[model samples]
Target: MSQTLRVLGTSVTLLESIRQRAEAELGIRLQYQVHDTQTAQRIAVMHPERYDLYDQWFHNLDFVWPARAIQPIDTRRIALWDEINDLPKLGRLHPDDRLAHGSLPCDRLFVQPDGRLGSRPGTQISMLPLTHNADSFAYRPEHLPAALAGREESWSWLVDESWCGHIALQNDAAIGALDAALALQASGLARFDNLGNLRLEEIDQLANCLIDKQRHGHFAGFWSDDREASALMLGPRVHIQSLWSPTLMQLHRAGVKYRLAVPKEGYRAWFGGLSLSRCVQGPIKDAAYAYLNWWLAGWPGAVMARQGIYIANPLRTRDHLSRAEWDYWYDGRPATEQLPGSDGLPLIDPGEVREGGAYAQRMGHIGVWNAVMDEHNYLVRRWGDLLRTAR
Candidate 1:
């Protein structure tokens, strides 16, 4: 009866942050029940009422079934929902993902972003897309072929075979081994979903290839975090890492000389959102909504976009971006602070990527990326084995 909300989530760091914020701002306390993908789904079944809220992928993946299990939010409460007012959030999401947030908002939906505001809110205003795992090329400028310069009309270059060795791929085979599949996809090597699927064999082939390159020191290093990838670019002899775009953005600013590209072969994406448990009712609900509202407006919105995950709210401002942030994501900017042979880098900003579709809109994603995360062990292990024996 007192206002304590139990949130079922994946990350302890994220949940901890929420717990702290809830206590500080609204005087509410959130009790989080942590679960990885598999565990979370089971939690959805076993203790339907045990959780007041659930963290989910925004793409209507496995996490969405919980919504089917929970009560659909009724739009009849529009005014009660309208009580929260702050707007002008950062959106500029991929055009294709627009439907993801057509009707929802912090207004009625009980969702919040750890990066702040991720994907979209649902049509019924019940759910929110929290984050996006979008794939774009992360390359060092010095490593780019001078021939590919000025021809940035589309994304055919990454898969050209000519650009192979300089590439740094994600180490995990099954889950992280997407771009390899994407390479197969882009090159017409094999095709699956825009949000694709990979057979065990294809995954193995990629894994072996990755291992071969890795052992030979064909990479700068494996990137564990977006920021770490950025550091790799800014640090030593590493030229490219095909991880997340966040690191590329950072490297671009540090004068590291890099490029985050959208491949002609196409890029990959995976995103997640939030859902509230059915039996959740009353005061705790209000506090949750409050947290969501504050998170989507002003500074928080800008921070999220700058971090590289895509957003869904049009109300978030385009102007909120710092010049470097604007240049990195919106426009194609070089990675280093200086031209490879020059003393200092000039502020080079191209136009199309500036008006670019959101990653949520353009790239095909790993539907419910978290679902496949569990398979990563099998995937990585198999890939590693092939790398040793074959490649």
Candidate 2:
């Protein structure tokens, strides 16, 4: 009899192709529960018994680990652990670079001897590093304001009054709040001592700033997922907004003239991985490990690469991609020819170069990582208030 493992996560990795491949090759039945970021995080923390595997971002580990919702993953059991990049082990792609702010994956990677999470390398880890990307907003050049014609791309444009009533933002507290704070600071409207961890007063300041903007019709709307963002960006409804990699790909396939900005202020980065539920054991636990190992085994990473996401062990994925694909996606070369997306349709045309150059070049300039802040509970309450009142 085939064992079954249920995975809980947002749409990032709960993709149909991944699920089908895992079921076919591993001989295990897989069930995926996809939700918006907050809903999925809540269930993973509050209802650990509902899923056997957790497929989500590393930032959520702040709440999930402390609550005992997920168990440690032994690195020895992961087939590609040895080949995983140093980014998760050292917090920086290179040893000399300063660590990016927020809940970086490396900071919570290793399982300490005291049974808590820490950076010290050990036999066990909090999550298996899988896919990641440096994210920034995408905009339609035709809708860009005249005043900003010669200006380099910057986060400040998200709040600039010239573009008021035409900009959309991601509608989550943790991720969206960071984007807002960056914009507010870039626009000289507000300041935060640490972009990653906001004090209560800082949260209030952000809330008030956004509230004032909403009252004046500065924002077009808010989006909870890439699909919603895609709709908002289509036509003339929205000209600029926070965007994800998959959404960028979708817009391209639909013939939207979009450019993923290389903001002067840098990008917001996120890393995603898999973890086991606290309640899983025996046969199910074994199957969970099997699924985790499969993600780093090349094919899945290759699929995500086509969508512009970076795998942990990109060298392994390199083998599965074409020469043109490897050059365009990882090396940041202009497409020598058209390139297909994960769906195997031409998504990138020749002569187009990736916005931010190579993998190292893009990942090097992170402004912050998505985080569960120290005052996350308070942030959530105020964030809900802003969304409800703004709408």
Candidate 3:
């Protein structure tokens, strides 16, 4: 009987190349279940037996860690533990940014000697840092009128009356709320004291604004999966919408011209990593460890870099890429030659510069990280109401 490891995560981590490579190299089969952020969190917490590992954003630690569904990962088990970026270890990427704003990587990341998750460094960690990057909306340049050429990009455009009924928004509440809040503030609709963790009243305000916009036909549609998001961008002709990096690459590869905006309010940053399920043991547990190590071995990171996702340990990925790939993806220079997407086919044209400039410049502009608010339950209920009415 062949060994199989069950993993649950978002579509980003379930790439075909990564899976095939792991299987071929590690001699284990992988059964991957894809879910939206909320659904993945629910499964990881409520039914830990269904998966051996979970890859998700740090914001979800609020729920999953309390449920005790995952076990601490010993740094010694990971092959390249020392090489991982210090941004998470230091808590803040830049001196000026608050610890709360940059994915909160320091809080509850390490597993302490007492077996509780904490910021103080120890032998164990809650998760193996994987891929992370800043997120922003994308728009079709040709759709804009010549009169508005070179207009500064802003999240407020999502709620602008000019694009009414032609805009799309993400379906997930945790992220969608942040995006909406950013837009609400940018558009002068309303403001929140803390965009990452909204108060109940602030949640209500944002939800009410979203409902009003939906009722007035402001949103063309809401998308949950990458395919649905891609459809919105390529078909039915959405002018602007919230986008993931991979989906933007998909649109670009398909010959659709789109521009990823570096919004004036700053980018929404996030960090994601892999966690072991409490149920994994014996051979399956060993296979899970192998898989995690394989993820940090550089090839997977190189594959993801094509889609604009940065790995936790960039030095490892450096070995797997050509100088040009490294320069174009990390240094934010114009591509000297055509570069392949995750599929290993040429996607980026020569001389095209990456949006948002270099990695440091991009990370420096982070306004807020994705987060689950203290009032997440209420936020979800209100978000559901908007979805139902919009549909």
| Winner by lDDT | 2
Q: RMSD of each candidate?
A: 9.0, 1.1, 1.8
lDDT of each: 0.47, 0.90, 0.86
lDDT for model 3, on a 0 to 1 scale?
A: 0.86
> Residue 304 CA error for candidate 1 (Å)?
2.1
Clashes of 2: 0
Deviation in Å, model 1, residue 353 alpha carbon = 7.0
Best-first order by TM-score: 2, 3, 1
Q: Write the per-residue lDDT of candidate 1 for residues 229-329, one digit (tens) a residue.
A: 56666665555556664454455456565556655544455444456566766876665565555444433444445445554442353466556554454
The 10-residue segment with the lowest total lDDT in model 2: 382-391
lDDT of 2 by residue, 240-304 (tens): 99999989988998999978999998899999999889999999999999888889899999999
Q: Model 2 segments beyond 4 Å from truth?
A: none
Task: TM-score each candidate.
Answer: 0.57, 0.98, 0.95
Count clashes in each candidate, considering only residues at least 3 apart in sequence or on different chains. Answer: 23, 0, 0
